[model samples]
Target: MQVAIDGPAGAGKSTIAKKLAAVYGMTYLDTGAMYRCIAHCVLNQGGNFENTDDIIRIAEKAAITFDGDRVFCNNKEVTEEIRTPLVSRHTSDVACIREVRELLVRQQKAYAKDHAVVMDGRDIGSVVLPDADFKFFLDADVLERARRRKKELDERGIVKSLEKIAQEINQRDDNDRNREEGPLIQMADAIVIDTTGKSIEQVCDAMRKYIDGAKA
Candidate 1:
């Protein structure tokens, strides 16, 4: 079983994807983390984001893998490193490159071939797993999404103004939607869930109903 969830950042894609994966006994693949891995790689190497060739080269040579919730890039654990604000700001730089997305998408597709996976990202449903058994597009108000992101960062001891975070999210939305490569999009067949005022449990339970009904 393959489940593809697509949404902007902080729409609870990762959180809900993990929950659904566990409940259904499927592996959860955070495809956004894979792109972040490439971004983190470029930063560590002191490569320029504007240099698409350099970014692509870094992505080509980076080895990214996931173990449970931990993310590894080139054998180094970067679960936390990739989530830093710095990396988050630059992730779209690498993700927008055609070569970079192609490289990561290949890896994502290969993993699904071997495992019953629940994968989430900007382009998972539309590009990476177009024929997935289930496709969901999760959305929330921009301010609500920003609040969720701020909460996560606060828990990590990273403090940023809510206004600034909301601005960044808006920028990210534009980038994800406008990028030339595999962009973030909601497929017509996908189940669209507006999670503006919903709790994680609420969202998960709602999705479970759909899956359960299909199974029945």
Candidate 2:
């Protein structure tokens, strides 16, 4: 079974998906981290982000894996490394390539084939797992999303200007939505949840109710 959660940044997809996977005893896949892994390689190897071919090459050569909460690249632990400010700036670019998305999406689907998995990202519902057992599109006000992202960064000890983070959030949202191939969009059947004021448990509880009732 596949439960897909598609949403923009900081809408609590990662937090909710991880918890939901634990609840269902399913594998948790973070597709955003896959993009971050590619971006990390592009920047670390001095590859030009503007060169789509070069970025794709780096992505192909890079080995990305999620063993529970840990993210690895080329058999090395990069769980914390890719979440840096540098990777954040370049990840959008890396994710925009058609070839890269195709590559990663294929791998994600392959992993979900033999087991129940909860995968979360921008295009998971529309592109990666259209036949998912349950789909959700989580959204909140732009201000709320930015605030959540800022809080996360602050807690991680990554100091960044609020104005800059807000601008980047808007830019990424626009890019992800407007991209020609596999843009970030909600499937028509998706359950839309406005998580602006909801606690994590509240969100999970609602989803759990949906899952249990549907499978009952």
Which structure among the candidates has the greatest lDDT?
A: 1
User: For residues 130-167, what per-residue lDDT tens digits would candidate 2 score against the true structure?
Assistant: 99999999988788888888888899998888888888
lDDT of 1 by residue, 1-216 (tens): 999999998899999999999999999999999989988999999999999999988888999888899999899999999999999999998889998888888988988999999999999988999999999999999999999999999999999999999999999999999999988898999999999999999999999999999999
Best by TM-score: 1
RMSD of each: 0.6, 1.0
At residue 107, give the lDDT of candidate 1. Answer: 85
Deviation (Å) of 44 in candidate 2: 0.2
> What TM-score would candidate 2 get against the native?
0.97
Alpha-carbon lDDT, every model = 0.94, 0.91
lDDT of 2 at 127: 89
